[model samples]
Target: MKQAFDHLKAKGKPDCTTLTDHLDHVVAATVKAATAFGMNVDVARQGAILHDIGKAHPVFQHRLKDSYKHSPTDEPMRHELASLLFLPVFDKSLWPVMVEMVVAHHKSTRNDTKRKGIIDLDERFGPRAFALHSAEWGSWSPTALAILSAYGIQARPISLTEAREAYDYAFDYCKNTPDGYSEWKGLLMAGDHFASALVHRTYNQTRRLFNVPLLTYYNRQHPLYPLSYIAADSERPHTLVTACTGAGKTDYLLRRCRGRVFYTLPFQASINSMYERLKHDMGKDNPDLDIRVLHAASRLTVEKNKYEEKTIQGHMGSAVKVLTPHQLASVVFGTRGYEATLMDLRGCDVILDEIHTYTNVTRSIVLKIVEMLKLIGCRIHIGTATMSSVLTNRIRALLGPDTVHEVALTDEQLDQFDRHGVHKISSYDDAQERIAQAVADGQKVLVVANRVETAQQRFQALQIAHPNVPMLLLHSRFKRGERGRLEQQLTGKRLDATGRPIYEFNTGQGACIVVSTQVVEVSLDISFDLMITDTAPLDALIQRFGRVNRKRTPETIGKVKPVFVIAPPETEGEAKPYELAVLEASFNALPDGDVLRERNVQALIDQVFPDVDNILIDKDAIYVNGRWRIEKLVHKPKSVLFDALDIDSMVCVTEADQQAYEQAGYEERMAYEIPVRYHAIAHNGLARSEGGNKPFIVPDKAYDPVLGLQMSLALPAFYNSFF
Candidate 1:
């Protein structure tokens, strides 16, 4: 007998995986995945085994040895298509579902782009074609027999007639049950992907579920006012909470969870902070809980640890997952990997925190996600401090009335959390003296600017005027590492030698100033004595105000501090992100008194964001009502639907150290990263590097640690382009 290789990978180096081992692992994974959803185990196993049978073809083996080279004369050899050759051997009754899993493993049935002359059976399996494919039959014979024996199937001779019959069954199945057919196709893909990514063994369904009582878990660490007490009042899965800051919203969200939880935030920074907090809080009691943080660079953060070398691929079985809403937005956009996401999220409890913080496009997409999740039977829980009645009514409209558990703090409860007093500024330059005096009086002052350039300018002016005071400048423009360290210092805590937190709240000794952008709105836990900010939407202003007097008591509610609001931007274009009408309306609606009440803040949001229909621009309308209509919701665009959020933005590196950028790991390289808009790059004369796939970047000297990207340095002549 001739010696056979016995194993092969579809791609990669020669020896990483064998054909049989791949089949074995995938079969087990598919069975576990399908059985989780109450599917037929035998059918799932048959699909998994049959999916890769054509990989054993002699032509495939020769191509694998040559790393899969193809010539124009040779017919394209797709294992997914080739597997159809053996479909006749299966029970004819099972061909409809089983053939789908085999042939559509690597491609979409609804969006199959390679179906012209390729899927035609007569052209592929004609009399002369059998002679032409003798080598393929020769190599496939032994593996096919082994697979049949491993799967306990009766051996039978495969023929072209049976193959044609199988194709007819699949074609009829697609015509009759399109939606149900897609479900099986998606489930099969999910199982195949999960199993193929497993490094050690198959899926483990024996793991323990999260059965610990949330109230008991919170009791271990005495939270000042446990919101769990309110949440524990009912056992409903869907909830809507509207509570102010420092009211234990996180605990309330968790208390309502009955199964695995998916907690989503608005920003990447906020997601990172929440991940660490949950890791420490929940990890203490359930050390074995699989809590994964999904984000763009999450793998980079964990890969630096030597012990976690094989944990890069995400596992859907994680008990708790902290991520940004962009991850869930994939389902709304119909991205390629959305099938696995659909499997993971179905029947899961999803917490949407800070829903008001997203842009109009993201907000529209999130609502669509809510619509689909409701259809798929996912329990949706939304938590926001500033939701208007109009938006609330729309949410009710989509989710159906009386279906959600709506909960909010009473007027009396909201009054106790009242903190900031508002003072509108008429004179811009004269306000500098007030900030200087506040810093000199041993008070912690915060300055929030509408733009990064404005923040940098304010920070420079403050530094030159009060050089002795300790000051920190923060924004999205800073490197990831520096931003993390700055957040640590601002929060005033770090881990000790034994991994316990060390308190470092300001003690009213030396005065300090923190100049930052809108990044401080969501989840950073710090209280400032005074705040100076520019005019923004009412919802945003409420979130910004939550940072001041955050830990107030009933006695300190009305006596906390004051927030100074600067004049609105000169023109509508100046407020690039926020709607100009919303900003103007918010400025008009502020109470005249210096004492700003928390209850009044809610009224202001209702006035400003009462209806998004009146304020949505043309571009926003396209996303919300036009493209994402109910009928067109599942239409897959040529590109990602969520690509608008990150379009024209690139992960740029300086031109001087392109080599160093390439050599450094993801974490290390992100330390020097700067986010430059495409418009800025176009006007600034920056060029994309020719080295690899790195983004277009300016010279090193263009970026400053304190001032961020200095457009003038790169485009001194065309500096007005940005302004």
Candidate 2:
């Protein structure tokens, strides 16, 4: 009896779950999600209710138990196509929409990989696939219909011929996709994802979806922060705040939003910091606000919760989200789940924090993103420290010049944010006297390098030079857990309810030295009394200068400190990422031994990036102009986007943690990953683990608990100190 009762199971992998239970959970989710998104709720609900009835067929049932051990034919029946067989039982008016919602939840309806789509199946099977799906239709149709009737859906028994006829109708309708995306597909995908992840708890989370957060916390104005005094409300639909750092750009951007927000930053580390800050500030008043951070390792930043893990992966209903713009780039490429992401971002407020953090390719993609956001009715707010005229004109043109509310600090006000004097140094070693003097004076110091190897070397030499002073090294190479701990140590502060810091980072105790890479350009919240940095792009260097003398208050608004810029390296090889011309231009453009005036920054930026809009984006991009450059329902492979992303493609873990990595849970496993470029480890001959993220197992000597991954020490090197 017990074995027979399990005949209507919908899912078999991991464990068997009943069809009716899954249907009910998804129905509740779709109804709530559809209502919140202003979509057709009945269409969503009916589609959800009937989408999985095909699982009741005996072939799927047999495969559900045996994992498709020996199939009746070569290709297993597509559940998405089989679900259409029961469409005749639902409201006829909703059938077309229902077909859109169900035909491609897991795969594209046309141009699916390996010819697995509904239309592909029709062509492959030549109308015999429906008969294959109806081996036990008489026995299973009653059970499936009874489950539907329980949801108040009246239906008679669906015959094999009737099911085949339904398949024919759905196949003909799905033969061609629209010129644009299908938001109905997005709704179904999101709903199905939530229900599948949360099960019976889906409704509880659904009630928390799309709750617009209260941003009154940002309204606290101070005279020192001039952007706070400027009125954020305007008749314009979009906004842009061009101001120096410490000018209250974040608060002004938040106040401009009229709906749920998608806060996009250029880096994941900065995204994590903003997520924590906004969560702390807003959680006190609006307890139900769904604030989430998004990135590859974002889950490790927050508390371990199943719903949070699935809900924050570029999903809908996050009240306030902090993420990298790369997360939204798929919309332009029409990658998998692009429609769902577009649906979530539709009619929302998007804040692009820093304009120049991306390289030439990503900058071009961001230009396309601005275009997509404009088309889909999203209110955009851009915050930048330094931006060129060409890029500004491009953005202004895309956003409509007359409709955008552009606010920048006046010349007098920009003078207030001038807190760092640019000092040219021959090399980092030349800053020894200044660093020693600052350490003696109990002042914090920062050192920046362009490459991770240089940063590690600088840290070692500095640690030996300043043997007694507290020192730390921070870069993008650290593991997620270690990085979080380091960020806390860098700026950990105890604050009163009024938000004034009582104490922070060993305040009033002593000085510390932080050696880092260009990552420090936009990630940290702490300020140093002095800075020593290698020359980078002028805009990037300006962002690095923001870390020094950054503690601004009514009294400390105009207080100036010193920042040393090392001369650019000799050759293009030395400047691995940035162009040598740009680096030299950035170095030469700085006003040595003088205050870096904020009013002259735009001219400086334009000097460095005279033709930032001249970069080519068409070769790698899938969306050009207002229309997609790819097939209607087809998408570019992830490799293409990953290449365009310009991020490290592969991850590796130490040999010591391979077993632990393979056995770890989803949340715990993320901590072990160390993102690396594929070519970097391709010749290492390391055993790759078949686990989460599929990381290659490097030798234990390559990684250290304190120093991070050392590629030179990856192999057995007798001279390497890490060994």
TM-score of each predicted structure versus truth: 0.84, 0.93
Model 1 C-alpha lDDT versus the unseen true structure: 0.66
Q: Candidate 2 residues 465-544, lDDT tens each?
A: 88988887887777776777666566664446796764534353678888888766784576889999999899999999
Could you tell me the TM-score of candidate 2?
A: 0.93
lDDT of 1 by residue, 219-303 (tens): 3323345354574546455788888887778877777777678888876657767877887788667766666677764553342
lDDT at 411, model 1: 83
**Cα deviation in Å at residue 275, candidate 1?**
1.0
* Stretches of model 2 off by over 4 angstroms after superposition: 1-7, 13-15, 66-74, 122-125, 128-132, 304-313, 493-508, 613-615, 619-623, 628-635, 716-723
- Model 1 TM-score, 2 decimals: 0.84
Q: Each candidate: RMSD to true structure? A: 5.2, 3.4
